[model samples]
Structures are given as structure tokens and as C-alpha cells.
Target: MAKRRITQETFDAAVRENMEEFEMASEEALREAVEQFESQGVDLTCIVKAVAAVSSEDTPEESTHEVLQALDSLRIGDNSASVTEVEADMKRFTEHCLVGFAQRFLAAQKDAYPVILSHCKKSVEEPEALVNALSALAALTNGQPDLLEAEGKQLFLDVLKKHREDPSVTCVAVRTVRHCCLKHEQNRQDLVKGGVLPLLTGAVTQHSESAALVKEASAALRVMCYDDDIRATFGNAHEHAKSIVLEHKGLKVLIQAAKTHFEDTSVLSELCATLSRLAVRNEFCQDICDLGGLKLMMTLLADSYETAELVRQVLSALRALAGNDDVKDAVVNAGGVQYIVIAMNRHMNNAAVCEQGCGCLSVLALRKPENCQVIMENGGALAAVQAMKTHTNSLNVQNQACMLMRNLVARMPQYSQPILDMGAEALIAQALLTHQYIADVGKAALRDLGCQVELRELWTGEHGSLSY
Candidate 1:
């Protein structure tokens, strides 16, 4: 039997018939249709196109399952169809909403790991195939990162090193690494051990023009930095994340990227998050501020309406930078105090922003009476009290708010009467009574509020004894 001659009319009619059958096909019928199409040598692209034409709302789960099975059966690697065949199959899967099949196929097929690994190894000369293969690996191991850590870690690192010149390849490679590192500590440690930071930093600093590369690299760093062990490895006694970033000249790279892509909120958000993570070390606070991180953060808080993520990161970074007196003075001079208060009020419902806002106020109010006065003038004290009252269940917010209140009243004697009048004492009392773990901070705040004797008596009455 000769191959059926599939003319344009024949192909279109086949697609139309398949589309009609697909709309009403049951699971078994869909499987049969897939078998018939494959047996007739119908182009996979046509089937994908026909299925894609159906309204996604009406596409049955069985149809998706059959389509995924057919697409995954496409041959890849040497001695098989050309790279174009595998790439087209992958493109179709990704484009036609069948990408979910990547994970399912890999999960069901025991040999998928070796098969994808072989293809990735052979496709080094082919960037498109390499990217698609990496993407497939990423999808397969997305939530299941042990697969990548066990097999594909070195493969991905090699891709980043060898294909640094190709922004597309670099982008997908870093993104794959980022996905593997998502919520998986072993994968993150492997990435750090594999020297991912230098590769990612090089991608950002050396290839500054590729916004996609920079964004993905920044995002990868952001995820990697979340691990305290990784952060400690990057930071030292004199600097937090700043030492490592500065060692690779990554700070300048990141700063330049933030400046260059000022409008790209995704880039800025990740970059700022990375900075905030680094600034967690007290030693890096002054360095971050001196390196112009303070100015950039102030600008972002002042202008961008992108998302709460950026605002959250900006407030967090400011909270870290405000630890140093010089940095605190600079922040106040840059009108950061006002913006911090604004963030508090704008995202009043966001516990994280409220916590960080109050944190910044707490640190700034520590030694700077003038800064404390500035906070009081900008309603920082009231905001802190309100945040504590609003997030009564959040021990973090309550503790930080208590610290802020204590700092404000302790440093600026003039603002003590104003804070008391705002009913901060009531909020503190509530925190003391509700959260015993934070009772110490609350008790200290009461003392700072000029109610030490009353707080002692209240504590004794509540607990039958007073420890502090």
C-alpha cells in the first residue's frame, strides 16, 4: 500500500473532520482518532492546529491527554528525525497548551530523563533545539527538582558556560536553573557549588543588552539568595551579599541593569529582592547605601506603579539600609522617611510591607532623635500603632511595631506625648496580653512609653509574677 496522497484540500478536510470529532469525542474515541491520524501520516502540526482552533473552554481533558501522548511520541536524538522535527513537536506542545504534557510524559516514562539528557547533549550545536530541550527538562522537573539535581545540574551549568554568547540560550538555561532551585534547597546548594553565581553575573554584566538574560539571571539570583547558607557563603564579616557581588563586580552590573531597565518592573523587582537579601547582614547596610542602592530604592518607591512585589522589596531594602546612622541620615535627607510612611499607608493591608515599614522606622528612630521627630511628624508612629492593631495575629508585625514605638518614644522625648495620645499604649497592652512570646518587647515599649510602674503591675496581675 502506497502512502496516501495528502493534498491541500485533503489536509484541510482532514483537519476540519478531526476538529469536529474532537469537539465531541470521548476519551476512548479521542485515543482512536489519534491512532488513526498517526497511522495515516497526518502532520502533527495540523492536528495541533485543529485542536488549538477549538475554544479552550470546550476542549475536553481526554482530548488534551491524547494530543499530549501523540506529541510526546515524536522521535528525538541521533538516528532519529532531524532537529527540526523535534523542535517543531516541542513548539507545538508549548504553543498549543500541551506543554503540561511534558511533565506528565516524563513522570509516566521511566526513560525520559536519559532521553532528554541525550538530546540536550547532542543539541549543543543547535541553539533552538537546546533551548527547547532545556525548557522540556525544566517543565519535567519543575516541582520535582531532585530529577534535575540528580541528572541535569551539570548539563544546565555547561549550557550556561558554553552558550553565554547566545542570549536566548542563556535565558532559558538560567530560567531552567531557577525553576530547579525553586523551593528545593539541595538544588540551590548544588547551583552554588556549581558556581552558578559567576555564570549568572557574567551573563548580566557581560551581556548587558539582553534584557531577558538580565531579568532571568536576576530572578535566579533572587531565588538562590533566599537560602541562608548560600547567602552566608556569599557574604563575609565585613559585608553581607555585598562582598561576593562586589568581588565579581556584580553590584555595578546589577546597578547598571537597574538603571538601564528602569521601566522593566520584573527586572527591578528581582534586582531589588536580591539586594534586600544581601542587605540582611548588618555589615552590608552601609555598603548598599554607599553604592547608590539607596538612591535607586528611593526612586523606585517614588515612581513605579508596577506591583506590590517591587514595593515590598523596596521597603525591605530600606529597612535594612536604615540600620546605619550615615545611611539613616542619607535616607532621611532623600525623603525616604516620607516614602516609607507612604508605603505603609498605601499597602496598609499588606502585613509584609507594614512590618518592613515599621522596621525601617524602628531602626531610623534608634539613635537619631531628629529622625524620630521626622517619623512622628510624618505620622510614622501612628502608622506603626495602626499596623500593630490591624495585624493582631501577626507576631512579626506586632513585635516590630512595638520596637518602633519604643524607639520613637525612647529617642524623641517630644513625640512621647503625641504617640500616647494616638492610643499606642492600648495597642501595646493588647500585644502584651495576646502574644506572650513578644511580651518582653511590649513590656519594654510600655516602659519607654513612661508607664513602667503600671506595666509592671499589669504584668504581675496577668501572670501572677513579673519576670522583667
Candidate 2:
């Protein structure tokens, strides 16, 4: 039997007929239309467009499934078709909201993974097809981790190693790996064990000019470092991840990527997030500061209002860095105290931001009377007090706020007068009344504020005694 030739008129007529019987069109009618279009050699794009045009917004689930099945039945060659064709088909399926349905379809077919893997393996030999196939594989396996873990993981890793020098292939491979590990902790651990980190970090360094590559690579690293087990290695006692990163001079690579593509917020966000995770340890904090992490973080904090998560990560990194006196001073010299105060006030409603902001201020105020003065002059004290008052119910915020105030009163008693002028005693008394565990610290702050009368009244009211 000879295949029919499809003309625009034929396509238009089919679309009109489907639209006229949109609600009445049975699954059989939809399947027949797909078969007719395929027999006529109409491009899948045209077929999809025609289907989308005739399909009502409330198209029946059965009809959608039938359309997906019809499209999947087409003999779209993995190797013979132009890369553009394959890419177009993949994008079209996704655009028609069929990827999830396709995954379901593939799951039921036991040989689905082997077929896709076969194409992927061949596509890698042809560079153009390789990118397209890799992209298609990524789309197909996305959110289908079992399929990936079972078949695609080693294939992607092999591609990553074989084409490590090709930026395009490397980018897609890293992105696929990222998709594989997302929401799958075991996959993340396996990737780490398979030495995926070095490849990803290398991508970040070698492809500095390729923002897409850098962004994907950075995103992969961010996910890899997301696990608590992996992140724990960056702690004071464990520097495993940090050691590898710094050993490969990964921090410098990251800092340069951040500087090179300063305007790419996704890259910046992911890169900053990765650096922040690595900066969890004290030694890494100093390493970050040594590599000019403070300046980048402060710059990010300057734009805190526009990017809340970025600001959150920067604050976390800053908190770690501020634990070092020299870094604290450097941060202050960089106008960090003022930025932090602004961040607190700007994002007053965000508890995480508030918690991290107060945490940073607390460290800066510890044993550093000058920092306390800077905080006071810059309204940091009022900000800290306000954080406590606003998030009075948040124990972390309360504890951090109390600790900041405790440091202020303990290290610099002279600043207590200004604090008292700001109604510090009432705040302390409230904190005392609210959090009894910090009652002693709050009471001490009140005494530092020359509020002995109020302190005694608080204790007397609570204990029914003026023993102290």
C-alpha cells in the first residue's frame, strides 16, 4: 500500500472536522487522524499543532492518552532523522504536556530503557545528534529516577568521561546527572562515589565563558552538596568535600565564574549556594574570606531585597565567616554591618533571613566592642531587637536575638546607655518573660542598661522575692 501525500488542505480539513466534533470525537477518531497524518508523511509538528488546535481545553484524559500513544507509534528514527527533527519532536511532546504521560507509557514497556539507551549510545558518536539525544534522554528520564538509576546513570557517566573535553556534551551530561540525583539521595551518593564532583568542577573551570555550562555544572554541584551527609564533611572536624574542592582549586574557579558572569543570577545563586555549603566549616570560612568571599557575599547582600534565597545563602556564609575576628573586621570594613542591618529590616518577615542575619550580627558582636558600636550606630541593635519582637514566637530568632544583646551588654557596657535609650530594658524583660532559659542573660543585659530597678521588679514579680 502506497502512503498518502498530506497537503495543507487535507490537514486543515482534518482539523476543522475534529473541532466541529471536538466533544463528540471518540478516541477512535483521534487515533484515525494521527494514522492519517502519519500515512500522509505530515511532519509531527504539523500533526501536533493540528491536534492542539482541535483539542478543547477540557479534552478527555482518554483522548489525550490516545493522542500520546498515536504519536509514540510513529517511526521517528533515532539516527536517521536530523537532530533538529528529534529535538523538535521532544520539545513538541513536552509542549503538548505529554512528557509525564510518556514516562508512564515507557514505564509499562519493559524494553523502553534499553531502546532509549541504544539510541543514546549511538547518538554520542555523532556530535550534533549526541547533544540532541542527550537532551532527549534527559527529558525522557526526568522525574523517572528508577529508569535512570536502572539504565541511564552509567551511560551518562560514560558520556561525561568520554566527552569531558567537549563543553556541549559535558553540559548536557552534567544536567542529566543533576536530574538523576534530584530527590534521590542514593543517586547523589552514588554519583559522589563515582567521582562526579571533579568532572562537574572541571566543567565550571574550563567552561567559564559558557554560562549555560557553568550554570548547569554549578547547579549539579549544588545538588550534590545538598545532602546532609556530604555537607557534614565541611564542618570543623571534617573537611572532606572542602579538601577536594580546594585541592582542585575549586573555590577560585567558583569565584571566577561568579565574577565572570556576575549578571547570571541562576549561576550566581547556585554558585553562591555551593560556596555557602562549603563554607560551613571554620577552616573553609577562612578559606572563603581569603578568596574574597566576603566581597561577593556583601555584594549579593546589597541586592538582598530582590533575591531572597541568594540573600539567605549569603547570610549563612557570612555568619560562618564572621566567626573569625579578622573576617568580621573585614566584613565591617566592607560595610557589612550596615548591609546586615538593612537585610534584617528589608526582609523582616522572612524568618530564615532574620535568623541568619541575627546569627551573623551575634558573631560580629562577640568579644568585639567596636563591632557592637558599629552595630549600634548603624541601627543593628534596633534591628536585632525588632527581629525578636517581630518573631517573638520563633525560638531560633529569640535565642539569636538574646545572644546578640547578651554579647553587646557583656562586651561593651558603655553601649548599654544607647541600648536603654532604645527601650532595651523592656525588650530584655519581655524576652526574659518569654524565654526563661535566657532569663539570666537578659537580666544581665538589663543590669548593664542601669535598669536594676526594673530587673529587681522583674525578678521580684516572677519569684516573689528581692533576694538578688
By TM-score, the best candidate is 1
TM-score of 1: 0.73
Candidate 1 residue pairs in clash (backbone atoms < 3 Å):
none
lDDT of 1 by residue, 1-468 (tens): 544434323433454455566664434444555567669765443232223223255643323333344345544324577767777765554443334543334333444555556777888889988888777666655555556645578888788889989998899889888877876666777767777778988899877777788888887877776553332344222332443466666666787888888888887877887776666555567767767888899999899633677888888777777766788899999998888888888888889888888888888888888888888889898898889878998889999999998888786666777888988888888887788999778888888788753444535435466687
- Pairs that collide in candidate 2 are none
After superposition, the stretches of candidate 1 with alpha carbons farther than 4 Å from their true spots are 1-85, 88-111, 183-186, 228-243, 280-283, 305-307, 432-437, 451-468
Residue 336's lDDT in candidate 1: 86
- Cα deviation at 116, candidate 1, in Å, is 2.5
Per-residue lDDT tens digits for candidate 2, residues 1-468, read 644445333554565566567643545555767676777665544233334332454643223333343235323455576666665654553343334543333332434455556667877777766776666556655665556664566777778888888999998888878877766666776666677778888888878999899989877776666554342343221333564466667678888899898776777777777776666556667788778777888887786446777777778878877767788899999999989888889889888889888888989988888888898889988988788778877777877777787788787777777777777677767777777787666666666666774444435435455675
> Per-prediction TM-score, please?
0.73, 0.66
What lDDT score goes with residue 401 in model 2? 77
Cα lDDT of candidate 1 equals 0.71
